[model samples]
Target: MELDFPKRKIIHVDMDAFYASVEQYDNPDLKGKPIAVGGGSKRGVVSAASYEARKFGVRSAMAGYIAKKNCPDLIFVRPRFDRYKEVSNQVRDIFFEYTDLVEPLSLDEAYLDVTQNKKGNPSATLIAKEIRKKILDKTGLTASAGISINKFIAKVASDYNKPNGQKTVNPEEVIPFLEALDIRKFYGVGKVTAEKMYKLGIFTGLDLKKKPLEFLDQHFGKSGSYYYHVVRGIHTSEVKPHRIPKSVGAERTFSENLSSEVFMLEKLDSIAGELERRLQKSKIAGKTITLKIKYSDFTLQTRSKTIPYFISNKELILETAKELLYQSELQDSVRLLGISLANLNTEKKKAAEKESVSVQLKIEF
Candidate 1:
């Protein structure tokens, strides 16, 4: 059965090294130099790395000490989240000018459905270029864009030209594009999945497409079906304007391994406070509270409970975390502690329909 649906015009806009760029833009001395937004301390992790730092193999989520080793002159700047948020809002405002169907993946990137845009612009390629230009004019920062018929291809295409560029995968090009794409280049296929695909002889989209639906399903379970359809240029995910988060969480890694539950209370308290602040900021609550523990050896464990009523206050969150902590004994010295709330009080959006794959003439919306 062929998958088919309305050929919507989707654009994925991703800011280039957003946090690092923001730091450079605000401080002239930092521009064109190797800089990381965070990871100055012993336990620090790099939040973002400038292109200069990336040349030396420094990357976000890498250890600070390693980043420093990679780029000896790498300057570590403390993150100014408030300033970044301000700039992110400015960029998002530009998106709102084009379409109301905007789905923010993070502060750095978003997916836009301009099938029926406010400007009545029919060419998604042109709209993507305009958006990137406006973002640069407004914020003095560059962004990359991917334009295509669906979110999956758009998202993958957006990464094709990094730093500052755009790529478009038109309806006619979608299939051949996917077939030639490296399996690692598929948006949702991560490092582990890519390795697994390699072992399965699925080195490219063509290899993935060659597998029967039953073979994929038998090997990859539910995700196998998704792979089968997406390779055929069928991804029906709609651009959600109000993307509700599945969970709100906060976590902390200690400089030293904490041996006792008593020693962890303070850290857990701080994490709960942060989680509460985030929940309050979003003006949402959840019935499920989860406590995550990472041992010194790096093994992780989680404990969760579902209360009848939703709670977003620190007192309640901390209370539940403590209870969960006491429910089980320590397997090893703790390295990180976290608290999260799920089962949020938000209505879920419905998925798009997949109908006939009859080749209808492409209509520019």
Candidate 2:
């Protein structure tokens, strides 16, 4: 087999404790304190935790009670999404100064392809350094960067340094670096996948690399081919300047669970209206509607319907969502209901369908 990977240089930039840092920077009283951004109530979850709070093992997505238990001094602040979006725009503007091939994963992280940047700079590392500097200078917040020949290696390299630092994995160094990496650290291998790999005696990148393609394909399905090539430093996913979104979704978590289907239907209507508004506002329409239900006991179920054409109006979205909902009996008293539109008229479905050869790697750190 011939491996002719692209020689393009890529960089992954990530903000450090973005939400918490924003809170701390804007509030003088929060400086030098262990703070988290999100809910303080038991039913809520932490959106982000400051480095001070992280020292005691606090982290994002942890339940509020667990975060508080980990760090008794943890100060929880409500999320300010509007302010964060403002700063994100500033960071993205700085990135555009270097490259147009920018793919934003979220407000705090993105992948940039600087193979032929606006500045014509040859070194991706230097661009990363300058970008980080500009983010701090403009936004008064720190950012970390990883540099490499492709997104997979670049994303992993970015986390090697933390809190306003950067690391670059040269093309020559990618193989050795991946060889030394644990399988658990691979781009898409999650907890369950790692456990499955461990049971198969595939504990490291080298072990994974040694397995045959057929074996991997049989074990992991479509992602098998992706894992096979990535381990050998062969990643072809392009740095799309326009990363079409996968879905437009709206969800609500109720303070009180609803048992009656009539009441649930009302909540779904509200969610569907919000979803329609967001979709229209984004100037996007989709062919598929998904209904997500989360029960009081934390279990979840989802139903989806893909229609023939795109629709963004509230009535159509509500009708489809309601139909999907009634297809199955309510499993339990519901606490959360969400409506989302997918199968959008974009490269999203195309990218997902042909994921074997050109799969964009997502950052998980």
Question: How do all models score by TM-score?
Answer: 0.87, 0.88
Query: Taking the tens digit of each residue's C-alpha lDDT, what string does model 1 give over 1-365?
Result: 34365568999999999999999999999999999988677677899999999999998878788889888899999999999999999999999999999999999999999988999888999999999999999999999999988899999999999979999987777889999999999988898889989999999999999999999999888999999989988887789998778999999988899999999999998999999889999898999999999886668899999999989999999999999999979999998899999999874665575465443436552
Where is model 2 poorest over a 10-residue stretch in terms of lDDT? 356-365
Clashes of 1: 0
Residue-level lDDT of model 2, residues 62-165, one tens digit each, is 77888999898999999999999999999999999998889999999999999888997777888899999999999899999999888999988888889889
In candidate 1, how many Å is residue 348 off?
3.5
Name the lDDT value of residue 190 in candidate 1.
Answer: 91
Count of residue pairs whose backbone atoms collide, per candidate = 0, 0
Q: Which ten residues in a row have the lowest lDDT in candidate 1?
A: 356-365
lDDT of each: 0.91, 0.87
Residue 270 lDDT in candidate 2: 87
lDDT of 2 at 303: 95
Q: What lDDT, from 0 to 1, does candidate 1 have?
A: 0.91
